[model samples]
Each structure stands twice: as structure tokens, then as C-alpha cells.
Target: MLTAQATSTAVSATDIAISLGLLVAVYAVLGLLWLFLVVREISHGPAPAPAGVVEEETLPLPSAGPLLRPAGGPMAGSGR
Candidate 1:
């Protein structure tokens, strides 16, 4: 009876250890896959601009028209 009990305990321990090892291996594989994907993305250059999307050569600034007024209104002899 004593020998049988000892054998059962050893088998249970081994099973638990194997289960933990398999869990670790699964997580390691997932981590490696994620690392590979990140590396691939870095190696590839930035994605191209969308089709038919136009980018301006230079940003347009507000024209110096009547919209630009000083704190004391238009300057003297500078046309209102």
C-alpha cells in the first residue's frame, strides 16, 4: 500500500510539472511570433500615402488684407 501511494504521488508531480512546462512553451511561442511581426513591420518602410490624396507643396498663410488690423486701428496715412 505504501509503495503504491508513493508511486501515485510521483506521477501526479510529474504531470503537474509537464503541464507547467507546456504552458511556458506556449507563451514563449506566442512571444516569439509577436517579436517577429514587430521586426517585419520595422524593416518595411512607412506605408504609402492613400491614392488620389494631394499634399500641398507649401501651406497657405493668411493674406495681408483688411483682416489684419492694429490695436489702434489702421496706421496714420497708411490707408484705412
Candidate 2:
């Protein structure tokens, strides 16, 4: 539909460039805002896991013993 009023006005190249520039600027601002919120939340850190899931009695650790041989075992260096 051609309206007499609409046909009379002309759009310029500068107007189109400005519109695109403004669109990019708006998107950039939104991206930066999203990044900032993400960084702030990451700085706050992960939430602590629920304590109820894990409950165990602490037992004394087993004492360390010889790595390889018992007292009666044959020595490793001896030719067999």
C-alpha cells in the first residue's frame, strides 16, 4: 500500500548506519551486563553440599609396615 505521506519521505545511508550501530551497541551492553553477573556469581563460589548425605565414624589409620618383605622371607638380592 502506497500512502502519499510515506512515499514522500526518503531514508538515507547515514540513517541506516546509525540504526545498525545502535543495535550493535545495545547488544554489547547486554553482553557486558551478562558477563559481569556471571563473574560476580562465580566470585561468590559454589554452594556447600548438604551435610546429611555423608556421616561416617572416624577410625584410627592403620599403622605403616615394611613395603616388601616379612622377617622370614628370602632376600631380594640373593641369587635363586
Candidate 3:
């Protein structure tokens, strides 16, 4: 009977250890989940817009100003 009681106690202790281990594992998983959620929330914040610098727009057509016009062309200023 003593041996049987000793065996029961040893089995109960192992059971308790396993239970505590499972509890610790559960808490660890929950902690990781919380951390992941926080990181995800931070990452989800609006992404920074392409640097606030403004770009200048260029014209597709060539300038028709006097200096830019061909020297001997009619568009050189004397329309005649």
C-alpha cells in the first residue's frame, strides 16, 4: 500500500508539473500574440507620403520665343 501511495504521489506531481508547463506555454503564446498585434497596429499606421518635395512641371512643346526661333526663319521676329 505504501508503494502504491508513493506511485500515486509521483504521478500527481508529474501531472501538476505538466499542468504548470501548459499554463506557462499558454501565457507565452498570448504574450507573443499581444506583441504581434501591437506591432501590426504600428505598422498599419498611414505610410509616409513620397517626400513632401514638390516637383516642377515641364512643357512638352518647344519654346517659340525670339531667341529660341531659328535665325533665318520667318518666326525670327520680322513676320514678313
Candidate 4:
């Protein structure tokens, strides 16, 4: 009877250990999947800019214009 009880306890301990090992393995797989996704995204080039936006190199520089004025209001140099 004592030997049977010892055997049962040993089996229970082994089952607990196996369950813990399986849990760790599952978490490891999930972590690996997340790492793969991150690496895949990084490997791909950056996403395209939204519509109606011009690249910095293609943008035109500001041209000289009348100094200061609220649109159609008195100009800065001209007295109000």
C-alpha cells in the first residue's frame, strides 16, 4: 500500500511538471510568433504617405510676397 501511494504521488508530480512545461512551450511559441511578425513588418519598407501630401524634396520654397497683411486688410508698411 505504501508503495502504491508513493507511485501515485510520483505520477501526480510528473503530471504537474508536464503541464507546467507545456504552458511554457505555448508561451514560447506565442512569443516567437510575435517576434516573427515584428521582423516581417520591419523588413517591409515604410508605408506610403497619405494622399495630397508632397514629398519634402518636391515641395516649392516660399516666394517673396508682400510683408504683413491680414488677407485684404491694410499692409504692415501702409498705415491703417
Best by TM-score: 1
lDDT of each: 0.78, 0.75, 0.76, 0.80
* Model 1 lDDT per residue over 4-75, tens place: 565655457779889999999999999999999999999997797798866565557567756566556665
Worst 10 residues of 2 by lDDT: 53-62
Better of 2 and 3 by TM-score: 2
Per-model tally of clashing residue pairs: 0, 0, 0, 0
TM-score-superior candidate, 3 or 4: 4
The parts of candidate 1 lying over 4 Å away from their true place are: 1-11, 54-80
Question: C-alpha displacement of 2 in model 3, angstroms?
Answer: 25
Measured by TM-score, how close is model 3 to the native structure?
A: 0.41
Q: Between prediction 2 and prediction 4, which has the larger lDDT?
A: 4
Candidate achieving the largest lDDT: 4
Ranking by TM-score: 1, 4, 2, 3
Q: Candidate 4 on 26-50: residue-level lDDT in tens?
A: 9999999999999999999689999
What clash pairs does model 2 have?
A: none
Model 2, which residues run further than 4 Å from truth?
Answer: 1-11, 51-80
lDDT of 3 by residue, 14-70 (tens): 798899999999999999999999999898996655886444453355556655766
Candidate 3 colliding pairs, count: 0
